[model samples]
Target: MAGTVSGFGRLNRKRSSNKEGKRKKAVYPEKSPTSPLASKLPRKQASSGLPLPEDDNEVPAIGSIYASPPIPSAPVSRLPARGFAGRGNCVDDTVADNALTASQHAPPDSGTVVRPLAGKPSNSFRDANKRPRSLSLDTAETPSKRKVTAFSEDAALVPTKIADAHAQVIADEWNEVARQSGVPEIAKITFINEIDHEPVPPDINTLFTYLDKDCLSSVEVPNPPKAETMPCIGRHPAFTDEGLFTFATDCKIIIECGQDCSAASNCKNRVTQLPRTIPIEIFKTVERGWAARSAVPLVRGQVLGLYTGLIISRTTASKLIGADAAYIFQLDMDEPQDADPSLVYSVDAFRSGNWTRYINHSCSPNTAIIPVARGSAHESLPYTLAFVATQDIVPLAELTLDYDPSEAKTFARKKYREKSRSKILKRKRNQTPCKCGTLQCRGWLPQM
Candidate 1:
């Protein structure tokens, strides 16, 4: 029994010595299990069931986990009350509320300093230099301050004859007699020295009967009586009369009553000799350079204007080249078979002319050049040219004329030949793309 008791005492001593050695070797000061500081420290995490390192300094504070530390407030400096400027003495409540809200939500460890949103005042400083916006309603009340006035009775009653005076001055400045030896400034043309006379009408059907069917081959042709010797016609002639002007008949012979006639100046038969009263204007065209447009409505068969220019001999015109030759119009007149072609006259309007020079050519023309003779003297020469509207034209409509009547027949023949020659289409010779915007456009302008 004594030996057993001695053995038990020896075992207890060995265990106590081993525990003391472990406590001496520990790096951290040991704390009681029930101490407040021990409870506040973070619990140890194990690595494969082993206890964590014993370093109390490495543990985070319990308060830090639950909430961030309080931020230090900036010091406020007192300033003289007079430094407040236009903001008045009262503090703004909105600025205080925004600052408190930002402080309450900001993270403690964030490196960036917190700032209130735009338009909110910062609590760190008092900006006495800031001036409140001006409340003056200057712009809203400006118009009412303007002075108003009424015209004097005498000022309103004064005679307004300035416009009439100005017109008189312009008339004197452009007087025909003072300007170009009595040639009108507007027409830019001169007339023969003969007095204006009413024209006598002819029986339309029989007008061309004077020309023999073989006149082109005949050696001799009868001439009309002299204007000075012809008897007067009593009244003006009507152009609208059924047979007065028709394209069906040759209508080659054109005669007009002269100074000896007893008819009025407003005579319908005398239409071509009258001044160009129709409103017309010159304008730039998309395809063509310059074109003429009627500013007023025109009726079919109505005389639009006259084609006036330097009447040069055909031989002289042939010698000219370029733009000058391009604008020359040969007089299409019936001649004796033996008549000299060299003596035939042409009108060259390139250098000196009126608006008719700008009229472009179209396959389908709205106007036609008609033969017109003012007097017996004019009858012997190639008839004077008159532009007559071939179709009813609206205002602002372009005035076009067929430069050559035979061109259309030629085009039709070529088109028929192209369709029969092969499956592939062929372009016409000397053809240019037509921009006339007409439904019946032949796809090209006819070359002269």
Candidate 2:
């Protein structure tokens, strides 16, 4: 998530930090610049007649500095530092200069034992001239001190989210799922929060099952005959004994000839056949919730991995999609097209899935799903897809895929957009505004 800052009081001020307190003490001069004592006194004794320390690092006890017969030393505090221009006319360059000069030159009077503040001295001080001219957008929208929080849907901010219902059950299940799937109990997720100080953990159910390999989802595989009729993309025992089938005749010949499925030279279709072993770290975001980033740079066109999840019937999908549409991918191909489109299949990673489940949507995506039919006897519709890099991706780059890949070609061409108006807007009525923050962002994730 992009950086956000909101909190009560002055976040920059440290109560225990004596140096910071003193430096920011410029909000008020020792005395009103208009005071007759301030104008008549020399710089060395100007700061409320306080016995200023010789070293700039030392802070005098905040009270009247001078004494003929030192009056009983008493405790006092300065509070005007919280607001930049809160003192209005009381603070000015003249008073601040006089105070600074006096504090620097005045020697400590041994008779008046002023207590030096505790803690390491900090040299930090604000520019004397710089003050808040007026509140800007940042100050205008600052959250109330009583309510500072980070939630999902900022679109570009870091990610996090939670719902109050069924908290315990969700947490238990989430912990079990993550533990079983080899996910760490805690990951060093780096994302700026609203306050960027205190952070609240997401509810127990915010994690994924962490699939290194594809696994069965809540919905089981179809019956043999019916499943066989469905088009298969890559090899899986559910579809075939050898678990190898493709749309390419050459690939079929090569793979059946006992070639290594791991090497590119051995099989062009091998990329999808193998498991995704790339170093991907799934981290929580400030506003986007959980997200994934690559640990290493990815070459353009490199096949990342096949998106896997529970293969559910359209009926099962209908019930779940309403709950959350982000992780449900429709899996249907024209070759094995169902007479009733509603009877088609979809993959839902919400309950159980791989790292790919954390990949979020981007209007202009870095990855594209390439449906590669294995080189089998005949071509079939791909039940799942392989995410291939559209461009060279840098390490730690958040991997994103276009939810609606069909919208790519029509981006620049008004003619194509006009022609495909029906197609583009087909899902518009059901979608939300896109927040990918790219220059070429289409303005909405039509399928978000």
Where model 1 places Cα greater than 4 Å from the true spot, the runs are 1-238, 241-249, 264-267, 336-339, 378-381, 413-434, 443-448
Any idea how many clashes model 1 has?
A: 0
lDDT of 1 by residue, 1-448 (tens): 1111100000001011122121111111222212211112221111011122254212110000000011112111112111221233212334323322332211211232212111111111112112111212232121111111232333311111211122122223223212222222443211110111000000100111111000110111123335443222222232433212233222333445433344433334454544444545544454654567776787776666655444454445445443334455655343332334343445544333345655776767787665555454323333456666777799778898766544444556866547742232145433345566766455554433
Among all windows of ten consecutive residues in candidate 2, which has the lowest summed lDDT? 1-10
lDDT of 2 by residue, 1-448 (tens): 0011010000001012122121110111121212221112121100011222364322111100000111111110011111212323124444433433321211212232222111111111231112222223333232212122432334212111111112222233333333332334442122222322111122112222333324343332231212222233233211122222211121111122112122324333343444333565555454455567777788665657656554454455444322233455655322132223233445655444556666766766677554433332211122335666667789878888666544543566787556554565564544445556777666555331
> Over the full model, what C-alpha lDDT does candidate 2 score relative to the true structure?
0.35
Candidates in order have lDDT scores of: 0.35, 0.35
